[model samples]
Target: MGLNGQIPRCEHIDRCPVVEHGPPECRACLALGQSWTWLLVCLSCGWVACSDDSRGGHAKAHYQETDHPVVAALEPSSTWRWCYVHRRNV
Candidate 1:
Protein backbone atom coordinates (compact mmCIF):
# COMPACT_ATOMS: atom_id res chain seq x y z
CA MET A 1 0.00 0.00 0.00
CA GLY A 2 1.04 3.58 -0.59
CA LEU A 3 1.51 6.19 2.16
CA ASN A 4 -1.91 7.53 1.39
CA GLY A 5 -3.40 4.09 1.85
CA GLN A 6 -1.56 3.64 5.11
CA ILE A 7 -2.26 7.10 6.51
CA PRO A 8 -5.57 8.82 6.93
CA ARG A 9 -6.60 12.10 5.36
CA CYS A 10 -5.72 14.71 7.92
CA GLU A 11 -7.33 18.12 7.57
CA HIS A 12 -3.84 19.60 7.73
CA ILE A 13 -2.67 17.67 4.69
CA ASP A 14 -3.09 20.66 2.43
CA ARG A 15 -0.56 22.63 4.46
CA CYS A 16 2.00 19.91 5.15
CA PRO A 17 5.29 19.85 3.23
CA VAL A 18 5.65 16.10 3.64
CA VAL A 19 2.63 15.74 1.37
CA GLU A 20 4.90 16.94 -1.40
CA HIS A 21 8.37 15.88 -0.22
CA GLY A 22 7.23 12.60 1.39
CA PRO A 23 9.30 13.41 4.49
CA PRO A 24 11.15 16.31 6.03
CA GLU A 25 14.82 16.68 6.90
CA CYS A 26 15.90 17.24 10.46
CA ARG A 27 19.26 18.88 9.95
CA ALA A 28 19.49 20.42 13.41
CA CYS A 29 18.60 17.25 15.29
CA LEU A 30 19.80 14.53 12.91
CA ALA A 31 23.30 15.98 13.13
CA LEU A 32 23.37 14.94 16.79
CA GLY A 33 22.95 11.18 16.08
CA GLN A 34 20.08 11.12 18.51
CA SER A 35 17.76 8.17 17.97
CA TRP A 36 14.40 9.72 17.24
CA THR A 37 12.09 9.00 20.13
CA TRP A 38 8.97 10.02 18.21
CA LEU A 39 7.82 11.47 14.93
CA LEU A 40 6.37 14.95 14.74
CA VAL A 41 4.34 15.24 11.61
CA CYS A 42 3.59 18.87 10.95
CA LEU A 43 -0.10 19.61 11.16
CA SER A 44 0.45 22.64 9.04
CA CYS A 45 2.87 21.16 6.54
CA GLY A 46 3.07 17.45 7.19
CA TRP A 47 6.79 17.75 7.96
CA VAL A 48 8.09 14.60 9.58
CA ALA A 49 10.83 15.06 12.14
CA CYS A 50 12.49 13.08 14.90
CA SER A 51 10.92 13.47 18.31
CA ASP A 52 14.38 13.24 19.82
CA ASP A 53 14.37 16.89 18.90
CA SER A 54 12.05 17.39 21.84
CA ARG A 55 9.56 14.92 20.40
CA GLY A 56 9.71 17.08 17.38
CA GLY A 57 9.65 20.28 19.32
CA HIS A 58 10.85 21.71 16.06
CA ALA A 59 7.67 20.41 14.50
CA LYS A 60 5.85 21.86 17.46
CA ALA A 61 7.71 25.01 16.75
CA HIS A 62 6.12 24.94 13.35
CA TYR A 63 2.76 24.68 15.07
CA GLN A 64 3.56 27.37 17.61
CA GLU A 65 4.77 29.55 14.81
CA THR A 66 1.88 28.68 12.51
CA ASP A 67 -0.91 27.37 14.76
CA HIS A 68 -1.12 23.89 13.28
CA PRO A 69 -1.62 20.63 15.22
CA VAL A 70 -0.91 17.26 13.61
CA VAL A 71 1.99 14.87 13.13
CA ALA A 72 2.98 11.26 12.41
CA ALA A 73 5.79 8.76 12.94
CA LEU A 74 8.91 8.97 10.81
CA GLU A 75 10.14 5.64 12.09
CA PRO A 76 11.36 3.54 9.18
CA SER A 77 10.30 0.25 10.72
CA SER A 78 6.96 1.22 12.16
CA THR A 79 3.69 1.72 10.27
CA TRP A 80 1.92 3.94 12.73
CA ARG A 81 0.57 7.50 12.35
CA TRP A 82 -0.96 9.94 14.83
CA CYS A 83 -2.75 13.25 15.27
CA TYR A 84 -1.48 15.70 17.90
CA VAL A 85 -4.83 17.31 18.65
CA HIS A 86 -6.54 13.95 19.06
CA ARG A 87 -3.52 12.49 20.87
CA ARG A 88 -4.36 9.14 19.31
CA ASN A 89 -2.80 6.95 16.65
CA VAL A 90 -4.47 7.08 13.27
Candidate 2:
Protein backbone atom coordinates (compact mmCIF):
# COMPACT_ATOMS: atom_id res chain seq x y z
CA MET A 1 0.00 0.00 0.00
CA GLY A 2 1.07 3.58 -0.57
CA LEU A 3 0.68 6.67 1.67
CA ASN A 4 -2.90 6.92 0.49
CA GLY A 5 -5.53 4.33 1.40
CA GLN A 6 -5.40 2.64 -1.97
CA ILE A 7 -4.21 -0.92 -2.25
CA PRO A 8 -1.06 -1.70 -4.19
CA ARG A 9 -1.51 -3.52 -7.46
CA CYS A 10 0.59 -4.92 -10.27
CA GLU A 11 -1.25 -5.32 -13.57
CA HIS A 12 1.43 -7.48 -15.08
CA ILE A 13 1.28 -10.25 -12.51
CA ASP A 14 -1.42 -12.05 -14.40
CA ARG A 15 0.55 -11.84 -17.60
CA CYS A 16 3.40 -13.99 -16.31
CA PRO A 17 3.79 -16.94 -18.61
CA VAL A 18 5.59 -19.01 -16.05
CA VAL A 19 7.23 -18.85 -12.63
CA GLU A 20 10.73 -20.25 -12.66
CA HIS A 21 12.80 -21.82 -10.00
CA GLY A 22 16.12 -20.02 -10.35
CA PRO A 23 19.43 -21.69 -10.93
CA PRO A 24 22.47 -21.59 -8.68
CA GLU A 25 23.88 -18.58 -10.52
CA CYS A 26 23.09 -16.19 -13.30
CA ARG A 27 23.41 -18.23 -16.46
CA ALA A 28 24.03 -15.09 -18.48
CA CYS A 29 26.97 -14.08 -16.28
CA LEU A 30 28.34 -17.58 -16.33
CA ALA A 31 28.12 -17.71 -20.11
CA LEU A 32 30.03 -14.40 -20.21
CA GLY A 33 32.57 -15.63 -17.63
CA GLN A 34 31.53 -12.84 -15.25
CA SER A 35 30.36 -12.62 -11.65
CA TRP A 36 27.01 -11.49 -10.32
CA THR A 37 25.71 -10.23 -6.98
CA TRP A 38 22.30 -11.92 -7.09
CA LEU A 39 19.68 -13.35 -9.37
CA LEU A 40 16.18 -12.40 -10.47
CA VAL A 41 13.53 -14.53 -12.17
CA CYS A 42 11.37 -12.88 -14.80
CA LEU A 43 7.80 -13.74 -13.95
CA SER A 44 6.60 -12.89 -17.43
CA CYS A 45 8.66 -15.54 -19.17
CA GLY A 46 10.62 -17.34 -16.47
CA TRP A 47 13.96 -15.95 -17.59
CA VAL A 48 16.69 -16.00 -14.96
CA ALA A 49 19.27 -13.24 -14.94
CA CYS A 50 21.54 -11.21 -12.74
CA SER A 51 20.26 -8.43 -10.53
CA ASP A 52 20.92 -4.73 -11.07
CA ASP A 53 23.52 -4.77 -8.30
CA SER A 54 25.50 -7.19 -10.39
CA ARG A 55 27.78 -5.97 -13.13
CA GLY A 56 25.61 -7.33 -15.93
CA GLY A 57 22.23 -6.15 -14.65
CA HIS A 58 20.77 -8.75 -16.97
CA ALA A 59 17.45 -8.91 -15.17
CA LYS A 60 16.78 -5.30 -16.06
CA ALA A 61 17.95 -5.93 -19.57
CA HIS A 62 15.44 -8.77 -19.91
CA TYR A 63 12.64 -6.44 -18.89
CA GLN A 64 13.84 -3.75 -21.29
CA GLU A 65 14.09 -6.16 -24.13
CA THR A 66 10.86 -8.04 -23.55
CA ASP A 67 8.73 -5.33 -21.95
CA HIS A 68 8.12 -7.80 -19.17
CA PRO A 69 6.51 -6.23 -16.19
CA VAL A 70 7.63 -8.20 -13.18
CA VAL A 71 10.48 -10.20 -11.66
CA ALA A 72 11.03 -11.87 -8.33
CA ALA A 73 14.07 -12.69 -6.24
CA LEU A 74 15.52 -16.04 -7.15
CA GLU A 75 16.70 -16.82 -3.67
CA PRO A 76 15.01 -19.83 -2.14
CA SER A 77 13.77 -18.03 0.93
CA SER A 78 12.75 -14.88 -0.84
CA THR A 79 9.23 -13.71 -1.58
CA TRP A 80 10.16 -10.35 -3.04
CA ARG A 81 8.65 -9.25 -6.35
CA TRP A 82 9.56 -6.23 -8.48
CA CYS A 83 7.44 -4.49 -11.09
CA TYR A 84 9.47 -3.02 -13.93
CA VAL A 85 6.65 -0.84 -15.24
CA HIS A 86 5.73 0.64 -11.88
CA ARG A 87 9.35 0.74 -10.69
CA ARG A 88 8.36 -0.55 -7.31
CA ASN A 89 8.10 -3.70 -5.23
CA VAL A 90 4.71 -5.29 -5.84
Candidate 3:
Protein backbone atom coordinates (compact mmCIF):
# COMPACT_ATOMS: atom_id res chain seq x y z
CA MET A 1 0.00 0.00 0.00
CA GLY A 2 1.06 3.59 -0.53
CA LEU A 3 0.78 6.64 1.73
CA ASN A 4 -2.82 6.97 0.61
CA GLY A 5 -3.47 3.31 1.41
CA GLN A 6 -3.74 2.49 -2.28
CA ILE A 7 -1.59 0.25 -4.35
CA PRO A 8 1.05 2.28 -6.08
CA ARG A 9 1.20 1.85 -9.83
CA CYS A 10 4.38 2.12 -11.81
CA GLU A 11 4.43 5.48 -13.55
CA HIS A 12 7.48 4.78 -15.64
CA ILE A 13 6.17 1.82 -17.61
CA ASP A 14 3.87 3.66 -20.00
CA ARG A 15 6.57 6.15 -20.87
CA CYS A 16 9.37 3.60 -21.17
CA PRO A 17 11.25 3.76 -24.40
CA VAL A 18 11.02 0.70 -26.58
CA VAL A 19 14.30 -1.13 -26.88
CA GLU A 20 14.89 -4.35 -28.71
CA HIS A 21 17.36 -5.45 -26.08
CA GLY A 22 20.06 -4.39 -23.67
CA PRO A 23 23.73 -5.26 -23.35
CA PRO A 24 24.68 -8.83 -22.51
CA GLU A 25 26.10 -7.83 -19.14
CA CYS A 26 26.41 -5.02 -16.69
CA ARG A 27 28.56 -2.33 -18.27
CA ALA A 28 29.69 -1.01 -14.91
CA CYS A 29 30.73 -4.44 -13.72
CA LEU A 30 32.54 -5.09 -16.95
CA ALA A 31 34.47 -1.81 -16.72
CA LEU A 32 35.47 -2.57 -13.13
CA GLY A 33 36.32 -6.23 -13.85
CA GLN A 34 33.69 -7.31 -11.32
CA SER A 35 31.20 -10.17 -11.49
CA TRP A 36 27.48 -9.68 -11.34
CA THR A 37 25.05 -12.35 -10.10
CA TRP A 38 22.11 -11.44 -12.33
CA LEU A 39 21.10 -8.83 -14.83
CA LEU A 40 18.12 -6.45 -14.91
CA VAL A 41 17.02 -4.28 -17.82
CA CYS A 42 15.80 -0.82 -16.96
CA LEU A 43 12.40 -0.36 -18.60
CA SER A 44 12.71 3.40 -18.63
CA CYS A 45 15.95 3.51 -20.62
CA GLY A 46 16.92 -0.11 -21.34
CA TRP A 47 20.10 0.04 -19.29
CA VAL A 48 21.47 -3.36 -18.41
CA ALA A 49 22.81 -3.55 -14.87
CA CYS A 50 23.53 -5.98 -12.06
CA SER A 51 20.93 -6.89 -9.52
CA ASP A 52 21.11 -5.47 -6.00
CA ASP A 53 22.18 -8.88 -4.76
CA SER A 54 25.24 -8.62 -6.94
CA ARG A 55 28.55 -7.22 -5.79
CA GLY A 56 28.00 -3.72 -7.18
CA GLY A 57 24.19 -3.45 -7.03
CA HIS A 58 24.48 -1.55 -10.31
CA ALA A 59 20.78 -1.82 -11.12
CA LYS A 60 19.84 0.07 -7.97
CA ALA A 61 22.66 2.48 -8.64
CA HIS A 62 21.28 3.15 -12.09
CA TYR A 63 17.86 3.87 -10.60
CA GLN A 64 19.38 6.30 -8.11
CA GLU A 65 21.25 8.04 -10.85
CA THR A 66 18.44 8.18 -13.40
CA ASP A 67 15.19 7.92 -11.42
CA HIS A 68 14.09 5.14 -13.76
CA PRO A 69 11.81 3.15 -11.48
CA VAL A 70 10.79 0.05 -13.40
CA VAL A 71 13.07 -2.77 -14.44
CA ALA A 72 12.45 -6.18 -15.89
CA ALA A 73 14.45 -9.24 -15.00
CA LEU A 74 16.81 -10.00 -17.84
CA GLU A 75 16.82 -13.72 -17.24
CA PRO A 76 15.79 -16.13 -19.97
CA SER A 77 13.00 -17.74 -17.95
CA SER A 78 11.83 -14.68 -16.09
CA THR A 79 9.08 -12.35 -17.21
CA TRP A 80 8.80 -10.15 -14.16
CA ARG A 81 8.89 -6.41 -13.76
CA TRP A 82 9.81 -4.52 -10.60
CA CYS A 83 9.04 -1.03 -9.47
CA TYR A 84 11.98 0.46 -7.53
CA VAL A 85 10.03 3.27 -5.93
CA HIS A 86 7.13 1.07 -4.82
CA ARG A 87 9.48 -1.77 -3.89
CA ARG A 88 7.18 -4.33 -5.45
CA ASN A 89 6.65 -6.37 -8.58
CA VAL A 90 4.69 -4.36 -11.10
Expressed as tens digits, the lDDT of each residue in 11-75 for candidate 1 is 54445554532455665467776555555555445565666346445665565566766666665
Query: Which pairs clash (backbone N, Cα, C closer than 3 Å) in model 1?
Result: 15-44, 15-45, 16-45, 16-46, 17-45, 41-71, 41-72, 51-55, 51-56
lDDT of 2 by residue, 12-70 (tens): 87667765555667888999999998888888777889999999999999989999889
Report the CA-based lDDT of candidate 2 relative to the real structure. Answer: 0.85
RMSD to native, candidate 3: 3.2
Reference-based lDDT, each prediction = 0.57, 0.85, 0.87
Local lDDT at 12 for model 3: 65
How does residue 63 of candidate 3 score in lDDT?
A: 94
For lDDT, candidate 1 versus 2, the one ahead is 2
User: Best lDDT goes to which candidate?
Assistant: 3
Q: Which stretches of candidate 3 lie over 4 Å from their true place?
A: 1-9
Q: Please tell me which model should have the higher TM-score, number 2 or number 3.
A: 2
Q: Per-prediction TM-score, please?
A: 0.47, 0.82, 0.81
| Cα RMSD to the true fold for all candidates | 7.1, 2.4, 3.2
Predict model 3's lDDT versus the native: 0.87
Of the candidates numbered 1 and 3, which has the greater TM-score value? 3
Order of models, best lDDT first: 3, 2, 1
Count backbone overlaps in model 2. 0
lDDT for model 1, please: 0.57
